[model samples]
Target: MDDIRLLPATGLEGLIAQLRSRGYRVMGPTLRDDAIVTGEIRSASDLPQGVGDEQDPARYRLRKRDDGAYFGFAAPAQSSKPVFFPAEEVIWRGRRDTAVTPDSAASASTPDNAGNPTTAPASSPHDPGFTVERDQLDAPPIALLGVRSCDLRAVQIHDKVLAGRTYIDAHYVTRREATFVVAVACSDPAATCFCASMGTGPRPAATDPATGEPSYDLLLTEIAPSDPDRHHFVLEIGTEAGRDVAHAIDTAPAEFDDQHEALAVTAHAASQQTRRITAATVRDDLRASAESSRWEDVASRCLSCTNCTLVCPTCFCTTVEDVSDLTGATAERHRVWDSCFSEDFTYIHGGPTRESVKARYRQWITHKLSSWEDQFGMLGCVGCGRCIAWCPAGIDITEEAAALGRMRAGGVLPTGDHVPTGDHVTVTS
Candidate 1:
């Protein structure tokens, strides 16, 4: 680990100014219409300070925290995924045109006007009847502030799926490669969080923290209460770029001692309170429960609205379409984000294979907890709990998984020869 730097809390504004001067656009969380949103920010004042949010299925609202801590909150209702994989983008364009040409043999036999035989009248290829073009967008370099630890881990997971092997997403790579991440440790956790069990949460720890394997360029640990008079920020530079950014900011020297270490320990412990499952048996347990009937039980109340996938930090499935104007003179192909829970997601030549609601629900859970490892060498879920919190029916994934875990332990099947767990279970239509 490189030597830490202490920056005056107000120096964050100067940092943003420096980045902007270098032609980078800064993006951070800010209070917008009673909710925290991520967008272009020019200075520290544009950030959400001392504001928190309350999130539930189909409901999200901002709240004021008494401490006035800038980043004292859990993950927001939105994730930064859309900034890379936009909802819609043009992939290709084509045009329709008609032209006349003489036969090759006839043209060869013809002579120039000066000789004898006049050449066939030529046509301008550039003067096409129709044409289509893509809109060029110059994506400026971005610096993300106040990113949670779990979401930072989720970004790595997405990188594996999108650019890990032969399949490389050009769109994702363009944005990801140019962006800089500034991660902040989670000081507050929500009730549905289980990042601890997934081994990706609480505090941002590299997959191999002891080996000094760093995952972020900059890591900020909120050391103490914010004081307008004498504000302090403990900054850790994980990479060369991070050190440059820190050096550019005009701030005080950071003291690294036993006190700062103790503060980090306290923050980690506070994060663990919301976690129910421990690291043990999370992957294997969820995999073994794939064939169990608990899926059908959970699917009963599922509306298949796909809100969970949209708000999740790591979900990246998409679909493409070719469209043309009414005149059919020009056409364009576009790609857009998609969800597995939607009916059109599973459509095939014959029909949708996972037609039943129960099957759709089963596929989603099994994919996230079971098959994701086989595909990406990591668990699909970071346990941000967006899926649980955004389910309109209040279907809790952690609760459902817990019920399955109990069934697996007792050697009973959830669907056959077992009783339902609670009143939340409803009969399927």
Candidate 2:
């Protein structure tokens, strides 16, 4: 750890004020609609202090913790994907007119048949040509607080897919570059979480495997047991911007004491999760099990509602739509999040290729676990457990991988709902 600092819980106010003073909007975990959600936060009081959550397969509930620690819980229902890659965004907009050309700018004059300059048509006061609204897109610098390690990695994964050299998504690139990330250690992961097995989290990792360098600007670790009287936070500055924020807050250097030791203890406890990807080569195992009966087994219980993909931070599938006004003069092209689970997602000239739930489920899981390595040089899942907790069918990815492995091993499985006995599995994949 470089430049470790001890910040009292009250120091959060100074941190927020410093970020705001620097033209950065502070967003953190807050209680909204009976769930922990990331939104605009004004002060430390806006954070969900003394609040945690209980999460299981297809189940999640808010609960009060014994202590008043601000970051006591596991991941919230929503990930930080929305902040960088929104559910829907207007990439470009244009206005059509008989009086002017589509390529003409708002300031340009249209030629009347004689090539004489004519007054530019007033189309709702704004420009007629395609305009990139930076303010509407919120392209300013943003400070993301309380970001989990798994989600922090997810943002990088999305960058690889969207902002890669092959085909760059300019919007994602700008937002990602402008965004400031602050990671919070997951002291207590949920039952559905498998970040430990995925090698993504439980702790805010020092170096990102994707980038081969520090992943966050700053990292926060909660220490409650260490200072039983008052909750303390260990802040680590990873970048110069992080150091500037610490200086602004008048933070002091932290010593390697009981507080850091206590934080380590809580972090270790979070790694004792039962759910895990047992396969040594999860990617190869998934590829070999393509013909296994596990697909049918999982499809029987799968709803194909796209909940898992929507909540998943690494899922980057999307579709573009062109919507025009009633006059058909003004139009906008929007990019919306899409899921492979939808039968229409595979739609071609004729019809959807993967019509059956078995095929669709198989494709989705295989792509996430197997082919993603070939395409992106990494596994798609970070093991944040958002897919398991958000899935209405309670399909656990760990158990599914285990079940699929067994079916591929012997070409036989527990059929007719005999129930998995002694498998130590709580959720089905």
Supply the TM-score for candidate 1: 0.84
Candidate 2 has a TM-score of 0.86
For model 1, the stretches where C-alpha displacement exceeds 4 angstroms are: 56-59, 98-137, 206-213, 226-230, 258-272, 414-418, 421-429
lDDT of 2: 0.78
lDDT of 1 by residue, 122-226 (tens): 444433355566556678877777777778787777777876669798777777776777777777676666776677767777443323446776766665545
Encode model 2's per-residue lDDT on 264-374: one tens digit a residue: 744685656778885357788788877665666678789999999999988988998989888767778899999999999989989999998988888888887889888
Q: What's the residue-level lDDT of 313 in candidate 1? A: 88
TM-score of each: 0.84, 0.86
In angstroms, give how far residue 155 of model 1 lies from its true place: 1.0
lDDT of each: 0.70, 0.78
State which candidate has the highest TM-score: 2
Q: Which stretches of candidate 2 lie over 4 Å from their true place?
A: 99-138, 225-228, 258-263, 411-424, 427-429
